[model samples]
Target: MPTRPSLDSIALMRQWLLLLVLAVIAGQVLRLIGMPAADFLGSMLVAIGLGVRGARIRVPALAFKFGQGCIGLLVARSLSAETLASIAHDWPVMLLATAITVVMSLLVALFLVRYGDLPGSAAAWGLSPGAASAMVALAEDHGADSRVVATMQYVRVVCVVLIGAVVSHALGSDVTPPQIPTGTAPLGFTVPANGILTILVLTGSVLIGARFPAGALLVPLLAGSAMQLGGVFIIDLPQWLLCLAYGALGCYVGLRFDRATFDFVVRRLPSMLFSALALIALCALSALFIANLLGKDFLSVYLATSPGGLDSMAIIALDTQADVGLVLAMQTMRLFGVVLIGPYLARQIIRLSR
Candidate 1:
């Protein structure tokens, strides 16, 4: 015999169900309208509205990690030998562009602290273009304001997606909605063999990556790239699985912004918005210089340097048929760089703000 759930528990379960239904509905609606990152943006909007309405819903922690793992596999499967070769050939430019982007982010954080009245530590983490969930978690650990950090990170994501869409539309880029995989494998082993190997590598990496910060995503990505480049196998994830991954990620992010979180930083939203736009503009200018130096097109450079999540940037690159390899290489390099040095820099900024 099982014990009965309490009233509070039952209420929480209901809230979770309601959240899921609304998120899916919103995501489908957004997809139908041809929006970039439709699942994420739509679910996020619904979650935000519900959160602001005083609903007590929370996304399970494992849900986020699972979503990250799926995205990791998707990106890893994309890495080809050509992509790696391009990064190697343009090593100097990649390093310089990544370094410049990080420095620019720091400068914007400083501006937020001095002029926008945000705390230095929070501003530092908030302005970072690393994975938003990771940044928010790290900010909380470093005694920064997690609420503000989350707000800044998501605000930038929304802006980046919308702006990227508009730019792609204006330039007559791909701008197609993300869909399930629908391509054939190159001349290689049987389909089942390749699929098994891909799943093994993806699962193994996520398990091993559990010990590292944001390792669940990063590890699989690296492992997948290595396997693909080595010609050991290929990855072609199914379409339905990709959709589920997108939904999970979007819903996870959406559920995090509850009413109290928003109210805490409501007054500073305008400043945060301005600071985010300024940072983006500065990064775009830097991309132009790098593009000219390397003879690469401006769109690739801009997307590579744009301050957004690695997953989001990869999606935009795929949609626009931009240099997916270069964008991934640049974004992956920066993600590692920031994860390594961001905490120390946050500490420095906090001291400077004193």
Candidate 2:
């Protein structure tokens, strides 16, 4: 007879089974109700609840990156030649709008420093629209309080997603069904050549992306775009795969909110919520100008300008049938801009505080 499984193995198995069941139930219920980012929102809530209950649930980093890569490919498929031309012509406006976002983020960070009593550097990194994990990882190295920075970064994420969904529903934008491209082959089917190229591009880009900040998402995106634009390949990913990606990404984010962390931030929750709302408002106002300048819809521009994660914004764009290309372009530009200059600006903020 086989030896009984170790306790750790048994515990791990139980955790996986629990998460899988909850994610599926939550995902199906949300999907039926026509919710935006249903898979993500549902799985995230489940994970968060599990964490609060003291279950050891975690979505690996590779899982998050895989989800990002899938999204990058999906967004790339939407970028045809005509859309690329539109993006090229509007590059200047996009650049300006991105610059404005960075400035706005810095201003908000400064406010947090002065009014919230957070360390200058921590406030800056926390409020920056760059990657939360990246910011938190770098914050300590730069003398920022990692705990505060993490708290601030994740609080903003939770607020952005919840408020964004409400805003979309309020505006009547979330009612639209997922708009798959008309000319695409049936779901679950892909041409072999297209599939091979798609796999190669995604795998290669992800490998290279490991070396660059936000590269897991951005690099795959660039690769997918190049492949599609160059006439090298056009693959319509299966809906199931997309759903899996969404779930993976959602779980990755949701599982991070453990009970201890949640408890620690409870007293300060109000300020965090207020700060998140304030930043979103400022970004929305800026979006109005960008929308006017670019002649796009206010909703699309607002989502693009919203200081949330790129993956989150992409999901919103896809959900609302917004111009995914423009949202991706604007968000990507701002991401790179912030990553490049955010450190220097953080230093300046620290100096000023001193």
Candidate 3:
């Protein structure tokens, strides 16, 4: 006969089941409200609550790697010939905006290091406007508190999403958000050859890059982007699959927050909020200058210059009918810029802080 399940094992199963159901509900609710990264936020919130209440759960290391890989592919899907051409057409303006944005983020990180309780590495990684999950992984490699880095990143994400929408609407994109869902839509409702190939590509890339810092995300991202832009293969992923990846990554981060780490964040929450708003304001000001120089619409320029929130920015640009291509080109450039320069910059900030 098979061995009997222990009481602890059965209870753990129940906890996991509850976590799944609640996470999906929370994610959908947030999504309906136009929150960026709803799935990640939803699952994280649920996991944090459960963790604080004495629930024992953990995401596997492999699961975390896979989650990072999915995010890489998500970012990669936006890479296309059109996006590249847009950048080439506006290379000067694009380069200026990207440089200024990176500087602004670093300045904010420097402020946090000088005055806030966070260490320099944590502040730098947390304040970086690149992909939130990718930043957190890099933070881990650099000896920052991953929990603190995560809080800083997602907090900024929330602020950026809300402000981006309000600005787009104020500048006269659709006065109301469109009912359509945002970002790279899945190839179809069904999985096809492209989807399978994409999955294989993601898995293989992650495995290949597994030994490096943020290799899982960085490798797949670069590889998938090149292949997609070169017309090597169409990158397709089902909605359910991406959701699973998002949830896995969120839960892994959230569940790892012990009571002490959570308390540390709560005490510093106000500082984090201030930094987020400041970054958005600074970026908005830059957008105004860039728009005047290029003779473009203010809304389109703002969306392009908005720090982070690539998907949310895309949604706002499309729904409000802003210059969708320009916004994507600028945002994608910043995404890659921060990803490439982030590690070196974070180290420099840490050194300067000391």
Which structure among the candidates has the greatest TM-score?
2
Tens digits of lDDT, candidate 3, 1-354: 886333234488898998899999998886676554567768877887776565677888788888777767766665567766766887898889989999998999899888787889889899888767678877888788897888888678757765775565455444332332233324332335677678899899989977765577668878888877766666776778777887897687667655666677689978888888888899989988999877888888887888765655654564565676687668767877887888899999999999
Q: Per-residue alpha-carbon lDDT of model 2 for 190-246, expressed as tens digits? A: 476566667778778877886777788888998888767766556556677788888
Off by over 4 Å in 3: 1-10, 31-38, 74-78, 119-122, 131-151, 154-191, 229-232, 291-354
**Candidates arranged by lDDT, highest first:** 2, 1, 3
lDDT head-to-head 2 vs 3, winner:
2
**Cα deviation in Å at residue 102, candidate 2?**
1.7
Candidate lDDT (C-alpha), each: 0.76, 0.79, 0.75
Candidate 2, superposed: residue stretches over 4 Å from native? 1-10, 174-190
RMSD of 2: 5.2
Q: CA RMSD for every model?
A: 5.2, 5.2, 7.0
- Give residue 252's lDDT in candidate 2 (0 to 100): 82
Candidate 1 vs candidate 2, TM-score winner: 2
Worst 10 residues of 2 by lDDT: 180-189
